[model samples]
Target chain A: MQLITVAGPPSSGKTSVILKLIEAMQIAASDVGVVKFDCLTSFDHLRYEERGIRVETGFSGKLCPDHFFVSNIEAAVEWGQNAGFKYLITESAGLCNRCSPYIHGIMAICVIDNLAGINTPRKIGPMLKMADIVVVTKGDIVSQAEREVFAFNIRQVNTAVQVIFVNGINGQGATILASHAAKARSIQTLRDLKLRFTTPAAVCSYCTGEIRIGNEYQMGTMKRMEFKKP
Target chain B: MNDTDILYMVLTVPVGEIMEKHPVCQNFFKNLRIEDIERGLPLHQALEKADPETLSEFGLDRHAIQREFCDFLNVFAGRSDATGPEITSITIIGGHGKAGDPENCQITINRGETISIVGPTGSGKSRLLADIECLANCDTPTGRKVLIDEQNLDDERRIELQGRLVAQLSQNMNFVIDLTVNDFLKMHAGSRHSINIDDTVERCFVCANSLAGEAFGLDTRLTQLSGGQSRALMIADTAFMSTSPIVLIDEIENAGIDRRQAIELLASRDKIVFISTHDPLLALGANRRLIIKNGRISRVITTSEEEKACLSEIERLDARLFQIRKKLRNGEIISRNALG
Candidate 1:
């Protein structure tokens, strides 16, 4: 039930970071699952067919984005893990940083495109402060001085957070960022361990329509549960 | 368990493309307070940006909206609900270039109900069903007004509500993909929102096969199903919906199912059920019967001594007419019963 959410501004390499992570995981023989909590994008579900990823876009008449992302991201992560994915990468909607790191205890990676300049950090100050990893994407587009200043300012807001440059085209600096992310813990996964509804009557805390009253393994480890009860 | 959803298993469909293909869906969006395409909101954020003021202003009721939307979608391929009808009105602005008798017509089944809409072929019986489903799903008459319990349904919410509150069973029950009986039930159950799966599955088995889950041995595709089995399967699917309160059934008699069993199922429920048929058995069983003649609800009989007598006489005349038509087709001369 661990969820690692990838957050960033639109067109700033958030999708790229997740795709690369998935590729590296597959290359390393690790099964990874990915889901997108999109706010402004729409497409056919089959686009994810090649990778075996399942997408569940938020429907109209449901709640707002902030609430949907946190809840839906949690559901997707749980579903993937149950399906035996070794890791789960969630791509968050751009322009919605208020609830970016708000997911209860997952490592949040904020992609800051260096080519976009220093103002990028200022526009996303709150997200950077909450991020566990601040990736300076499009590193080739920025001067070394600009990278240093960017990291320096980012480190000031969250001194313990890791900052690195990523040249997605050449695979430069991605290894370091990936390694840091690998060690980060997921709060949802940790909290999930405390669940002890020893009976068949124990409804899932995440999705109430499904209840776990006994020891059984479903196709997707996570039981198919509906949020809206009949 | 939340890990899988986080991994972004996407179920995205091009909203604009689908909306374009099914313009009536745009009406569903309009009902949600977004009338113009310029709002250009993506499907994921449609509910978020839905104008609350517009929904209220339109005076749309929530339950009806949910039911009608679900009803419309149930008409698609592999999505029949067979549960019965939910619509109150299906007003065609102009008949498909056929000379029009009525501009708008309403077909409704009220609460505590059993009812049927009866008509001759080309009398708009099937057309009425299709139009009702189109209106429910926001599919036809692009941007037209089709009300459920009198509240207007727009396209966005209509699609959202379609599966949850209304289910339909079309006449031509055919499938391209072969599936076992259980597979058919399971696929449909997954799409709906609120039913206890185990309980619903159990009930479905009982109704479908007239036996419990383990005892029901038949498991085959639509092509293999006898008229009775196919009709029963559809009925089970519709009756099982925890979402649709209004079930629209189009000519249950066409499948050669046991009419008594179907009637019993509808009679047992409190929800509205509308069935369109030519069978006298179904027509007489209805709580209300609307005789659609020449594409209009020419007469409605809820219950009066004279109305009851008139219906019985009409049924008699209908049976005689059917025999006469059959004999004439065979080139036989008219009999005394035919003349009467």
Candidate 2:
């Protein structure tokens, strides 16, 4: 089954775009499978199941959802393959800005809305830098100039990627996005695959079940930024 | 290179010849302002004739300059002591079990072969590894004798081979030093006399990221790396920079890195790799596996072609279980089809 990873910041309409993409896929919807990965809680899978679309949700409570997603992604794809799916869509939480979930030799799309600010394209990490296609969502709420500027910002960071204005509300560009995702190469296994970029180093005391909230409470691979003397 | 080689060059080798062979040393000398003055003079002779005022300005005397030059080149120059030994094979002469019943097993593993030690918890799996690590000569509690080249390693040979010839990748790896990943790799590459530190560092970084579940930036502090990240980093470092011909890895199932790829990467590097693991993939992956019972080498089993044929089937089951485990961790409800 061909695999596609969708990542962006929280509340960036990733679920909307995915649902719209599946809607545009039409007959391919029955053969498509999706796994929603979120940090704390996710209720988006219910929407997919309602449309008779195969879906599952994974909640990474304390760890970064992207890390959880990548670590278990191969298994998710294996499940999709076993279920006889044609496409397996993995939607990442992208809670941590630096955590990139894209893998090499796979079709990966970044869902960024025009309302997240034009500078967000450059501010985002490799999630935007290494994407195969940048789907600009929420273009309905912004002016044409803002849409042009957002596309320009995306180009500033990644010039080669195809930027599509996918309005998640009415599914305006979902067909184009779905065709791009459909053109992805069929992945037999993720065993030899490579992540396009590295996720952030994590697992502090809190990650290992630390409950307290203080400097003394913090432990385990903590990052302390070093600043030069003024 | 070793200290003796560098010292020999500094003492007698002509400046022009040294510069031609090691252009890096020229940069070091130029940066330190320790010029090899005469066109035909050796480093020592030129340093002796340096102006006293110039030497003091750089905060050094003739003796210190000569000494500093050796130390600088020692870290930056290529390794010349890497010709210590060509370890073709490692033989483990078995020892007694917990009951001291004179356990008898003689196993000889050749270079580029992978071996795994398997047994129950506290079955002396690690003890057998420790004997190999220290190259035991019936000296340890297990009374196991580990031989290099089928011959017992003497004290002098052991001392010469201690840290440089054997690399032990133990469980519970964490970086204590606070340095960037790039700097850490650079330090290792510098001491190893890597042809290109930048290229080596990049390769190590990419390899580590591939092995690790999570990727870390080159500038990421060593201390901030997760358990998996640090272990993957070390695996990559050992694979690329280590000159050690023999590698001993403790149980690596819980390291969060890809165990199969880790084994493959190390074994492909032309090293005799010995791993102690409880995981079936690792045990079956090895060319031969040692069965430990009650702190003794109970049996030695060479993996047959038939056993090797079952690996792919096992991999399929492993992938299935892997997905189930992911679902279990995600608090998702399992349907009947999850097993399929």
What is candidate 1's lDDT per residue for B1-340, written digit by digit as tens? Answer: 1323211211133446546644435544543435553334434444345545444433334443333333332332123333434543333232321344443434455554766788787775654544444343222322123456656666465543432344455455433335666665554453332235456666776786751111233366645666556667667655654334655676656454556566657556654667887777677767677666665556667755666676677656655665676688689998685677
Candidate 1 interface CA RMSD, Å: 28.7
Interface DockQ of candidate 1? 0.01
RMSD score of candidate 2 (Å): 26.3
User: Top model by TM-score, which number?
Assistant: 2
Going through the candidates in order, what is the number of backbone clashes in each? 53, 3
- Model 2 misplacement above 4 A: A1-230, B1-61, B64-84, B304-306, B324-336
Scored against the true structure, residue B19 in model 1 reaches a CA lDDT of 62
Q: What docking tier does model 1 reach? A: incorrect
Query: Model 1, A1-230: lDDT tens per residue?
Result: 34576767767877666655554333332365667666655452354445566555553123345456544554676677676766677766544433343443567788877766543464454466567778777754432223444554454344456676655654444444555556657443443432111111222342333355544522233434458876
Give TM-scores for every candidate, taking all chains together and pairing residue i with residue i: 0.36, 0.50
